[model samples]
Target: MSDQGNPDPTTMATDPTPSTTGPSARRRSLFKANGVPRSPREARASRIALDARERKRKREQLIMGKRFRSHFEDYEESDSEAEHEATPTEIQEINRGLAGSDEQVAKALKLLSARLVSPSAALEKFILAGECVPHLMRLIHSPNPEIQLQATWCLTNIAAGSEALCHKVLDAVPYLIQSLNPLNPDLADQAGWCLGNIAAEGPAFREHLVANGVVTPLVDLLTTSPNSQLTQTACFALSNLARNPGAPMQQLFDAGICGRLVKHLSQHESQDVASEVFWVLTYLTAGELQYAHRLVEQDVIPHLVAQLDKFADQGSAAIPLIRTLGNLSAIDDATTSRLLDHPEIIQQLLYWVAKSPARTVKKESLWVLSNITAGTKAHVNKVLKQDGAAVLTEVMSHDSYDLRREVSLGKREKLTGKMIRWVL
Candidate 1:
């Protein structure tokens, strides 16, 4: 029985092939009875509907195009807006923060000391430049070593690189030097870094320091300070003193800084200290071959050779160590030849050339190899016969033109024309 709730109108109609008469055809027929459009009118209405849709789409495209252009041109304005947004509302705030009194400066110095490694570079710049040295000096007496340390670093950075700041820094030197004796590593490092900066500005300040007997305290620090940073900085300062072509160089020699530096070189655990010691020696021995024999006599070559391998594991040390060696080799031909004779050095270098991935180490290795082989045909033959030509040739092709010329000239003097031609 058919359910009365269910419409049986289609079943009663007895239409055959119900599946063939699709709903679309039926709806079209029903539309004709409902006063809808005829065939021609229906086609016209469809065209109108399609035209409306296309117009809507074009309007949307125009809106989107306008949006894109606005976005593109607004970049500069937006950037300016962002910059304005970041114009540091904190300047007036910092000034206000710093204004109250001596106690306020102390509090700011303490707060700044905590912010030394802050994510804010602005805060660091402000702390370094804006604070009065006197204020920092007051905080230096605070029971906190960190506050003293930060105050020292801020002063060093402010004074180190600027000649205009030298007098200002010199004014602060007594306090800074006093801070050097503090048992804190941070304070010691800042003091040493400041000294290096002063010496780096050239012979003027260096002579000033030496003439004032500052080198004695600095050298004594190198000897007694267990702090690596301080010792290294002291050595760097001494190097600058020795680097002076004036009376300060003689002063360093007289002060016995050279011997102390050599002793510092062998004993330090810090490669940085070792590297600077070598540099100090380099500066001392530079142009004057008189010290070359002394350096060799003191057996500096073996220690340098031992440190050559140290560069393999620590790549940053490689360039400085290699440069130091090159400078030493440039001191005199005999010392250069003596350093070349160390079997372990040559082997370690050759091994690095073969295995080390560091481009700097490889370049340094090539240079050290070239320096060792220079002025000695026997050594060149030993290197070339050991199949070092390919590496040397590669270095010649890849290095700077000046270096390439030096290498080529040095190689030519060592290898026979036939051997040189064969390599080239």
Candidate 2:
């Protein structure tokens, strides 16, 4: 009799193959259509299926996992205690489910993705210890979009752990890159987020990302994605990729990322998006002088200057804008001259040095001034002409040692004897 009417496949007994006299026959005969196993073999099969069902139910309970939050923004590290500790047996079962049927794999991924949303170092360690990364990498190729998305999500969080744990997920980089298609923005967003976390690990991993050709698609997404969240996430990933001290700026420049970043900085309305774009520019400009010049060629300086007043009340946002200008100024007198070409840029820096409430803003502003003074004597005179000397004197007397140190450095840079007396 066919078992079509049985609601639970686990309890349905399959017809035994016809073997008139062997052990197969004996085992087959031991089970009834009613699913009452009359022998050890049938009983074991029943128990295994029941166990699988139970595990599936347990996994389903965790489907309502935590909502998605970008690791780049407000990511809090988990304490020593994990919110839900997984036992060795539980991890083993999850791993088994990963290798099980399609339904089981989906449920297992759901559970894994759910738990990883919060910062649970121990849980990540436990999962890694179970050797489940290969399974996750495999699932990234699953035709099922939900499973593919969940697998990517799990890896994203895993990459958010320590550098060692992130290394374990590196093999998924290629598969993650494949998911960057603009047609699937949600999956692309998750993949971009994962790549960002991996790139954030260090230089080698970033090289891995770039070597795998992660830049082209990321730039594509940044430029073409209609979904603002995906666009922002792509920007975040590119920023991390460019963050390396040994970053492959040539590859990024070849990919035309610098121009795109400037476009977003000038046109994107979201402060968060603009802030991340600034970071990308900041890191890129911090590299070889060519990158700073490329940004200038993109007409980035005037856009950056315009943002100073817009982000003035926002210290976090304002800091990067100041730092980017400072990086340009430090490049050389020619680049510094580009910034000085805008007279308000100097006035703005002096205003922040004297009046901005954030110590970091004042510090970065003074740092830019120091770079300016480090340039030709004309740059120093321009700063002094803007009342920069008085600002330095006031800052030098402040209680903040860091600010005073910055002022002292600025005072020492090419200041005339008259300017020195004014600051002193």
Candidate 3:
């Protein structure tokens, strides 16, 4: 029996023979009508049939080509047929959809949000084609939680586009603020992301948020909320706002964010929130060194120092932790003294440069150390002795330094009876 069925009806059985099995001849199925070449006339008839089949196949191919060509040619001019397919403009569609039901508006905003991730031209196309931003701005106020959530989500991503594109949702700031309330943490989280993007833009966009008085309440959410999910999102928003250089540092500091962030940093065990605190600290310290004193007074330095070990070989915290340390230590007097005063800070920085898994951590540790040497005479002398000397020399060999100035720390401070330091 054949594998596929009982047997092919067209197949025939034949007796085994040397001549039939040998290469000189081949066996044939005895039961098939055309199993063997009975005569030259039979073979000739089979060849003719095959020729006809080939001609039929070519004819069919030609017909198919003509059919396709006809369809292609008529496509553009099929207006009369397509008249039934035409619909309203994109804005009209959105307005029409919104007028129907809550789910309808939510779905429309979801479609708009989905397109926001496209390339700039595509995003602009959707916005211009649908007049999306204005409709999104209006839909954000709908009483439905999901509609508000999606509107904020779309508005956030839209603002993440180019500066001109982001301007479209600037008017929606107040709505985003309203969405940040506690009735729905999910919606508030979405609103946080939206406002964060707006804050990430240039000075004008940031100024708009500040001018609208959105900063204080946003910070308050992170500081006061016990809900980790909502607080996590809020911290991320503030971090992005702080990322841009010259972001309103004093303004944020004045809002009591500094002290609250310090306290929040101490209790939050989640690395995500901790990373945001580090980033915000990095930004705040970079913009205004004066804020360093404020942070130290809040007793945040020890907590920041503790992160060097907690994240030394884990997660995304190492880079930011090291960066935060470098920024804090970069302040010549107030912050540097505070860092040295903190327990094991110098020892931790040394070990990090010597054994930390990442080169970035090691380099940032060196950064902190070099800045440390610029402090009081006692600070320079402390690194000159013990294991600190070995790491300091390793740092020197790996990095370029102005040896003339480096060796002259506190009027020629010496390491192990020899004067040396790294100027980086």
Candidate 4:
């Protein structure tokens, strides 16, 4: 139908040799390598598919972010609530967590010890409210060492401040006394701490503690485990029970607590232990004067005198022994004479009175001398000849006129030649 109609017919009729199939197939292979589907249906459908690794990573990040936000919000809420809602119920919840059987509570106890606000206050409230007594009792039996320790600590704090709590603690005394036998040092220490606090509140709960044979366990502990603090606390508890100063004193006297205590005091191991034992002796002697005489008859004075030669360091235990000696000397003539004649003790006392900078020890020295010489002319002369009067007169410079007049008159009344002549 064109000007070259004859030629067009010829070109149309020719098929033109099949185009090389290699390039088309190579193009298809390239598309497949790039993940472009060759099929129409596959290309039209979803082309991007997520792999397991990428999906898992996204999930983990999401979870981590959620956890972080949750904790952050919780911390903020806790802070805000602590300001206004630190009520009894809220406090109890926190205390329960602090004493929980979980490892979290164990961490909390350690954290609380280092914190400004003691978690123990909340614990005390729980105990006083009567809500957690059974829980606490059960917690004492927890398999976790830290939970048991914290529970014991909470009980100690509670018993220390509340009468009701002390009664509750009385119910648990047998259990605590049993815990004393635990082979662990820290556990035994905790038990000792609990008993100490209960005992410290005085003897209102004495019969409950003693009727259950509590002393035997504590005394038994001294034989095997001699933790200074534990032993000190035990001695203090025993002294509190014996505060009545009566025939019941024979109970402790019979247990031979005095001998053991003296033995501990005489040894220069730990100053704290020695100081506590010294204080216990002071309390025991002050209550019943015979106990002071009993100590002398048992040869405790010589050992005490022997300790005088061991000069105490900065926080010397010798000070306590000196004070106890002063008290015992005032209680009995036998102790007075024995102490006055102990050369080591006399020289140390004089030096401490005259030279030591501690006004307390210095004052105790003067007072000890006065107590020893109070009723006996021989003791008075011994002190006077030993230059005790000169030093005592010096103490007058530090005293009021009333005290000076008392000392001056006391010197005249006690320094008689008749008794001095007998001794010389």
Candidate 5:
């Protein structure tokens, strides 16, 4: 009831008019213009219209997606929109502006960056048509570090698009790495970001990163810089480098990325930095045998365990860290022993298995346990020594269905039920 002691303004008005059936009057009246009671037909039509509008919206989104993909894939120079393509004279003018006063060059690069960041395929094609990529690289060498930074930023954005754009940006790698010197931390950070974009493409560009000598310099940035942000960005750059499945990884291992990343993991002072380093190591271990051997040889497992020990309570880094350890643990029987030798690591995995609310963490934890058990009998005893039997039983009875299935599947072999019974 309203304050006036009625059924609020929403109550039917006493006046039931027949011909004054406008929207508001209809809302107020209990009878329609025909003096009949309200019916569901009108409301039904409205709902149907809303449903049709929703379907139309979905169709439009699908068409937009197709356009984006088509634009990204169309690389033929002749097929590019001619109107967006700058004239040769205009291209020469922009080129001259790039070599003008340091400030003008910086502004020009910034302008290019702003345009590149736009979703306009026409603008991206225009830049490509003008063949301005090589010029952008030279701007990285300008006496002014700020100009170098803007150029690097532009390169990074241009490199972030599809393969066409990445190929264009790859020309700037040698100069990009040069700007990553410690003396200019800001320039170094942005340069690292740019290299990361270039590396994010497929194997061809990742190899370009290696061919242009990017790994060691990136590792240098991770090690030499005081800025956690820079280190994290460097880690990002390396992770992309390590992601390609068939890319040659020997050079990356030879660069000491293993020990560096492990050390970075232990420095859990910054969870963000530790997380990035953990991902880099994780990808490295997931690669070829040489990559896993190098990371394990660097004693990554201990640091991986230590990372869990340090940040387990935080709950953010625990799952990925455990997964990385589990991946490394599968290297071989000896690597499993290395993981078993670290009983605390087993306990850490058990802790997550039993406590983490995420089934993914619990599943990975159980998988790692299964890997450890698959080793020599001594390894099984190492985990059993840590009360893993009880942890498994608890997880089996966990309320989460996925967790229970994961644990059950992980222990499906001979040792599972027998191990549980033996421990009990």
Candidate 6:
């Protein structure tokens, strides 16, 4: 007479526990009144529904446990709204606004950009997980310039996070590349900065950037943009693009970046711009000797020699110049001769070898001289004529093992037995 003895059919069908009657009774209860068994599709559907419900229950329990633990933990919440990570509900609202009317999209982007400006890794991860990247990528092509700019600003911050997060934003790259037009210098600058961050991830990302046609526009900005900031950003992006050893130097050469960089070295008064340009050259020359030869054809050797003399005491500026020179000198006799064409090149090398306090600079300068000495006998004479033997002897006695090793390997290998004896 009790409800347990006459359980509701709905409850019986849904419950996992068997009735006291038996397994056969429970199985019979699952069939229709006509005593036909449920079809295979119906059985499958029932099992799927049961699994979904079980999963949902478990997920809810886990979330509740996490919330309870967070509540009891010794955590101090920041008062700043920007410091706070967005909840799923809040992120969902943001996503809706992003896909909404023009006014809604603008408001959402402004809010997103403001939050990203502070560089919070947690916030970036939250936004990325919230599925905002695809929407941001869509907005990058928005006709509204302001909206496009704000969206790009958000993406730049996102890409500035870890390399894993940066990879998520790869789909936006082509759109970012298209944004690098001089007509929109501000947007172009932001886009270039974003591309630089993306390219900095690794060689694969750099290759993607190049394959997306970033070089030509970046070269245009570097050569002709009236905006100094834009030009500098372009240089930065290009430097990152060319940083890896396997970079497409031939493509960059065909784009005429080498010639433009040489002209900038001679004419640009901005030391920062010149430094960035120098880095691009260093990376490019790090490729095949043909690329270094291309730089030599640009008459880059004379400009580099002059710059090295002027900035010798400033290691930040001088190292790249020395490295570029070293890369050029390593090419062949013709290239080394072109470098030595300037009488002061050897003197500069000896000055650094004996006096420069930075071991790296000393090593690089020694590397240049070593390359020269390794050349024909005339090259060795050029080094010796500059009192190279005394500098080499001083380095041999120096405290740094690296400097001593460089001298031993470079001078001992190619120098005449007389010079080697003097150095050792």
RMSD of each: 26.9, 17.2, 23.1, 31.3, 17.0, 21.9
Considering only N, C-alpha and C atoms within 3 Å, which residue pairs clash in candidate 4? none
RMSD of 3: 23.1
lDDT values, one for every candidate: 0.52, 0.68, 0.58, 0.53, 0.62, 0.66
lDDT per residue (tens digit) for residues 1-424 in model 4: 0100000101111001122221100111123444445576654332222124323433442221100000001122111211111235555455666556487565444332222112245545655674566666777788877677766665664564456666777777887888777366666756765665565454566666677766777666555665664665555455445544221466667677777877786664865565556656655666677776787777777777766655343323455567677777777666678777776666778777667766556655656665766657667767767776666666576765544443454443465654333222
Q: Give per-residue CA lDDT, model 1, range 105-128, as digits (tens).
A: 545443333232121445434544
2 against 6, candidate with superior lDDT = 2
Please write out the lDDT profile of model 2 over residues 235-288, one tens digit for every residue: 667767776465778888888887787787777887766766676777788878
Across residues 235-282, which tens digit of lDDT does each residue of candidate 3 receive?
656765665554777778888888888877788897766765676676
Each candidate structure's TM-score, on Cα atoms with residue i matched to residue i, is 0.64, 0.75, 0.68, 0.67, 0.67, 0.70
TM-score of 4: 0.67
Model 5 residue pairs with clashes:
none
Cα miss at 132, model 3 (Å)? Answer: 0.8
Residue 315, model 5: Cα distance from true site in angstroms:
4.0
Segments in model 1 whose C-alpha atoms lie over 4 Å from true places: 1-103, 110-131, 137-147, 182-185, 239-247, 351-356, 396-403, 412-415, 422-424
Query: How many clashing residue pairs appear in each of the predictions shown?
Result: 0, 0, 0, 0, 0, 0
Q: Which stretches of candidate 3 lie over 4 Å from their true place?
A: 1-101, 243-246, 395-424
Model 3 whole-model lDDT (C-alpha atoms) = 0.58
Alpha-carbon deviation at 399 in model 3, angstroms: 8.0
Error of 3 at 130 (Å): 3.9
Ranking by lDDT: 2, 6, 5, 3, 4, 1
Which candidate has the highest TM-score of all? Answer: 2
Q: Write the per-residue lDDT of candidate 6 for residues 255-304, one digit (tens) a residue.
A: 88988888887887766666667667777787777777778888887777
- Who is ahead in lDDT, 1 or 6? 6
In angstroms, give how far residue 76 of model 6 lies from its true place. Answer: 26
